[model samples]
Target: MALKKDLKQKMISEIDGNKNYISVEIELQYQPDLIHLLREEINYIGQRFYYKSKDYKLEMCGIGYLLEARYSHLEHDEIYEYWQNIKEQLNTMVFHEDKHHLKFFGGFQFSEHSLTNEWKDFGMSHFVLPKFMITKENGRCYLTYTDHSHKFDIDNIEEILNIVESKAQARTVSEPKMVANKDIQSEEWKALVTKVVALMNESVALQKVVLARRRKIEFQDNVDVEDALQRSLDSNEASYLLLFESGKSQFISQTPEQLCQIENGKLYTNAIAGTIARTEDESENNILKDELLNDSKNQFEHRYVVDSIIHDIQSFTKQLEYDKKPTILTNKHLYHLYTKIQADLLSENVLEIVNQLHPTPALGGFPKVEAIKFIEHEEFGTRGFYGSPLGYIDLENNGEFIVSIRSMLVKGKTATLYSGCGIVKDSNAISEFEETDLKFKPMLKALGVM
Candidate 1:
């Protein structure tokens, strides 16, 4: 074991007094229980973030904040510009090896809208470089400590070492008891969908629009953010798992939709819109999948997504390709029509791609502007970070952004789950309602409320 005094002296020696910022990473031969550590520290730290890739190839746990850029009531492009300016100020260094890069984690709101009390902690756009992060990649783990100044505090280093070496038993988080579950805007959402369908049928230019609803679940005791995250991870292995906690609010998601993933100059995304509930029986599941694929309404919904993605990315992308026919992506309770999209990027400007490709037809609607207008005018509540682009971006501009769907917002003893369905000319009000209901089951089960 490396002595705490030796490590601290080494880190102090590496600090350059002239530089305004520094990042120090130490690779650990044995992996630490990051989730357990996060649970132990988040309360005192006040802000935390976590992410797990769909393939389980990458996982990160971030604590506190070394630097952060957050904005409210800013348009997508404006937020991008601000974030770029902030990135210009960062100067980082890594020890042992230069294999890993520092990353900023957070997300944008669904749109420029009023912030509900539940979502105020998360602004219109927010990203942070954590003071300390445990990154796990390909079975190896590394602990990174970052700060704004080159000066090192010996006491701080000693504290970090003690916490890392502690053999404390894992804290217990009993399953919380549910006191109440209420669906928000049930009748109003149905009415809004009916109106949107009528408008889509009336106008040739207006093809589709998606409407979302919220469900509030209250617990008898304050919910354990880490426990809920673990249950969600246990149940959802094929989706992107995310957590962003600030102050009293925590936003969590197990979303299957990839907004965009940029790696080695290659871009990857997905077109997921059409959906159907999965059944217990194998034959019945096959029938449901077939029904979803062959159904003209679902096909139209899926086609709109595919066409819109190609249209959005064509100007800045080349060699773009996707399946001509949609396939089934099965989740714990549902199946969605899925198409994988890949392209060669003309520029590695990730936020630019995010600005252009966000609110895909799957989450918003076809004819992006018109669909968003309909949602803004008709939707019952503000979306906050739900249905938004949420993920991490590294210094090299290579990272993944997943659509924040099948997600929830937690404050104290209450958790508010959000779900939505695309509405087109053929969409039935009752059917769309049922689809959203099926979408809520994953978070519900993860919370042990079902």
Candidate 2:
């Protein structure tokens, strides 16, 4: 605390001495699992805020936040509506970067599995510099964010501090309180679970039937979107949405697994399903991996995911590649079989494939349509962006979409964390409940859920 306080004081002093400039560079050395927590889901857009840091990460390109939506769910469509609206929104709306509004990318989508090693091509990536970048450089995961307020002077720090102090100095708002009741004891959810269990018993081939629960939190403060996000993210909670856009463009996320990424023309993807937390030691981790792989119920649950992604990409590209076997990625919290798949993306832009690939079995279910239907009416209220793609593909469409897992929706100090596990026919609700406990690690740690 002293170090951070001193650092902030020094930074402010420097700015004050400068008299008029806002060239501030802030860095946070995030922990490893914490970095992965950020990686768990990708929020492509937000109202308007900037944050960056590099702490702990696995292996991949380092990415970071660009700019907030200034308000979540900006009528950004105006930027593309007729292409002329771009100028209108620019004139009226506040964007992260004033000059460049969007980016786009072109790549092929494959389902048959091809390009397992070439991840840079299809692996998710972002332009970290010139703003923020989240990716792997060296071995550690690092995120670098740059803030250049056009409103501030570049030569004088005081000039910049004046604006930031005035704009960003809002008092930390209070946490929103939620009301829970005994309604859950005999709630429809209890009945829904029973019906789902019955369905699992009747179906011989069905692998997992993951179910979810929802509760509402009323928004209280007239808080800025960035404040809402910071409260949740700084806490290590599992959720991806934060009340933004003055309560309009709510930040929603749906990530738990890497579906696919395409760059240049290569496709990169991972197969993530089946899980168990670490009991400790390397051997303990290995045991969990083995159990997940051999378990019929687990395997069946994972296959649905593998099949969904494989087929989703097929609609866009023909050439593909995949590792004959799935590799287990052991995190402190859980284990997942991740197979690297790649392919030569066709001439279509990246969005062509992304549009069809979201909500794979890892999130929805085997059959996308059926799963979505079940989730919508069965999972309580709207999943909103909870299971949806929550990252940037850029205006150039050259960005990665992370499965918004291990995340939560933060409206204020109080936030809601969410976790889900694929429930196969043999899946026990109690055990699956435990699985969610493990999946909750990333966000839970972030949100102080523990």
Candidate 3:
């Protein structure tokens, strides 16, 4: 690992106009232990910094967290302009799926994200907003610094904010909202879901399967990306976040579950299965929570996810400790059975553990291969970034993943969102449909769709 000064120098050199283009990476060691140093750095960066990255040059498997930078315009494409400003600095980009292959219920003209909604939709906080992030996607990636040059004793993140502010124009609106036209009752969806269900039942799938839907919404006339991001931040459905690429805006999230979280050396994963929305009264809410917990079907539904995670994490950890009893967690709108699982990872690094553990019973079905095949071969629509984990992992490697239960991608005024659920023998189409509707609330409110 290089000293902090050396790493800062490397960053400056890479940014300088005079250097020959060569990819460079430097691991800066920490003096105050990895966690404290990282926490201090992230806390600082959270206040400032405009950031961007392509995608991971490093191998990614089950990412504990991922951070994605997105660009969205009002009515036209302007990525080239943004790219021109930082092309030389970027190292990778997130893969863009061809529109022809993707299904559209409400599919729109633009959607760009690094799958963090998969983590956020499930209620896991988006990646830690690392003081520094190694971000990638769309054939581009970069190691962005949140803080540099400890030489100058900066007391606040204002300088970083200034750097971010300088790169982009002020947002055009007070809030960004989603505009989509979707017909869930359409025959097209029926056929697609029917085919997917058959494939899932026949394959080595996880016990549950989540299917998502999306539609595109365009701004009526004038709206900026910043407006959308700010609206997302202020949405009641869920919290909002601004990833890398501080310029153009993309809004993601409203998830209600946590997939995996690593703090210090302890790992916590949640079994978020089953769903029931809250009502007007406390008595009704309590009843709903108890009903969700006591409901045989809901319990049965949740077990599939819990079991799958236990199996996956066990692949790397010798001693997996879990809260023996699952608990009912009530949120603003719904109630869910959330079981917390913890273990000390056996791998030398946390990234490996994430790879082996992702697509748990919650995301994918019981047998991952079959469930994936079912979705790939049978479903007419593509999931896009809806069901994928999106969050950030700092140099210390501690991070979290939300279920991606309620999230969307944005490009310009157009956007697309996705939602899915576990379909067991008992999962009725109508019930599952309702479940997905509840799931959409997070981003729905963010986009003003609801």
Report the number of the highest-lDDT candidate. Answer: 1
Cα lDDT of model 1 by residue, 1-450, tens digit:
344676667766777645566666778777676667776784554588889898888888888887667777655566556556655655555656646557878778888857877778876888888888888898887877777664444355446556766675856656678989999989988988888888878887889888999999999988787888888877855888889987788888988889999998999998997888888899999999999999898899899999999999999999988999899998777888999999999987788899889899999998899989888887888898899999878877797899999999988899999999998898899999998998898788778776
Please list the residue runs of candidate 2 whose C-alpha ends up more than 4 Å from where it truly belongs after superposition.
1-46, 49-191, 203-208, 215-256
TM-score of each predicted structure versus truth: 0.94, 0.60, 0.61
**Candidate topping TM-score:** 1
Candidate 3 structure lDDT:
0.47
Give each model's clash number.
0, 90, 70
Candidate 2 residue 401 Cα shift, in angstroms, is: 0.7
**How many pairs in model 3 have backbone atoms within 3 A of each other, for residues 3 or more apart or on separate chains, i.e. clashes?**
70
Candidate 1 ranges with C-alpha deviation above 4 Å: 1-9, 43-45, 75-89, 154-158, 165-173
Candidate 3 lDDT for residue 200? 47
Candidate 2, residue 324: CA error in Å?
2.3
Model 3 stretches with alpha carbons more than 4 Å out? 1-180, 184-186, 192-207, 222-225, 235-251
Model 3 TM-score, 2 decimals: 0.61
Model 2, 331-384: lDDT tens digits are 445667766777777743544455577667887676677655666556654343
- lDDT-sorted candidate list, best first: 1, 3, 2
